[model samples]
Target: MHDSCSSPQTCTKEQVVASAAPERTRPEEGHPLLEPVSAGEVRAEHVLRDTFGFAAFRPWQEEAIEAVLHGPGRVLVVAPTGGGKSLTYQVPALCLEGTTIVISPLVALMEDQCRALAARGIPATFLASTIEQGERNERERGLLAGAYKLVYLAPERLASEWLVNQLARIDVSLLAIDEAHCIAHWGHDFRPDYLRIGDLVARLKPKRVLACTATATPDVRREILERLGFTQGDYAEVLRGFARPNLHLHALRLQPCDQIADAQVVRAEV
Candidate 1:
């Protein structure tokens, strides 16, 4: 289940492994990689560290973020859960002078994300079933007032012609997709609404784009980029393997033990 409660517990080796299957992390706790020193424009170090609280981004986070931050087109990130995915585009969206539309799946998750960002003292909002017309108008006002740096919405909401008109007027800095793996033709339990995202991006005309997901196989990854119409050189794929090592290894041979069966049933119930 998706938890909006908090950053999970200090991930144990087993927990980390279980959560991220392929390998165990060193808990290299710190700010993500600071923006590289560059001429003319700021490297965005303060934003990376102060806003997001990372000493250095994982090997790929910085590269993917940079590709989107300063590039001809878009970037795709396939990272494990809690990989600081939201901040990748959120920080840049805030720094730039435009709105960023994040296409997310769950209404609850969207609200949770908007709440998390708001708690951090950021101007963020979401549109979903939870949003009433008054609140929706407020969100629109926020966007027109230049108060919202990032906005989250379910794909279905894009059907509103009025909303599309608003998008046409906004200087959208980025068009980002979360759970990007859903773009894959063979992705598990594909969401029908996801298939329209590429068209949505084209219409938004954002200066840049970023697609992110927690799980995707090689084939699935390819489909994500293709659906977005990203040329091979136009995007980068940043991925962390799927290997949850925290789970203890266990094996049992079924036996006619009434006590054992009772225990198994109880555990399943819980």
Candidate 2:
């Protein structure tokens, strides 16, 4: 149960990177009713129709959303980079009664996600190193006061006494681990903080849990499940494909080149 933000973090505060809504905004003044769909419905009709303005669900979003809304929930989505992993938990959080605690690997992702959720009329916030102790305390207090539906935090946040205490007081619906591959030592950017996740998740007592990753091989996927201690029957890996005919897999030794040109070249290719 997690959301993502899109700011590239620099071991510090996350920055905004989207078209933002005004602070403290709520559902529009007037709209047609978008009633609850079912007991298994994750995103309420209003979330799709009013908040996000999406008329229909995409691919497995509806199925994944339903799975989360139901109990005994754990999902592992191995979708590619653009498959909308964040929506799986965001929709469920919207339908649930409490917050979704998102475990993130990057500060920028948290900022981007929080901004998007905020714009969608979901009270979302983030915890980063930039805030002063006083402001940090205040934000924590405010969030625990039940003003927010989602909280974006780095995996390291779980190590803090303040975060632990604040989390204990809040009602959390889901615990979503984004870039879940980071939990593995074999991962390109292994993070020690990520290894502490399953324990932290048990402490939060969330109703559901979701671990997401954009790129994972068979071994990486197995390692991810083991790191999370997700039993064999506890989760499923939904893989779309492993082939990209357009890509030429090759290693190249390179010397430094113009940074701006390199970026421009890559962008043009995409």
Maximum-lDDT candidate: 1
TM-score of each: 0.75, 0.72
Clashing pairs in 2: 1-175, 1-176, 4-113, 5-109, 5-112, 5-113, 6-112, 7-108
Which lDDT tens digits does candidate 2 get at residues 167-225?
A: 87888767888999898887887888887886776566454778888778778877887
Lowest-lDDT window of 10 residues in candidate 1? 1-10
Distance (Å) between predicted and true CA of 98, model 1? 1.1
Relative to the true structure, how large is the alpha-carbon lDDT of every model?
0.68, 0.67
* lDDT at 253, model 2: 49
Candidate 1 residue-wise lDDT, 1-270, digit = tens:
111212231111222223432122121331122232245543556677777677777656666666667542367776778767887788777666668889998888888888888887878888875678898998887777777889897887777778877877877777889988877778895777788787776576455778888888878877887787664223445565555566455555565767688678868965
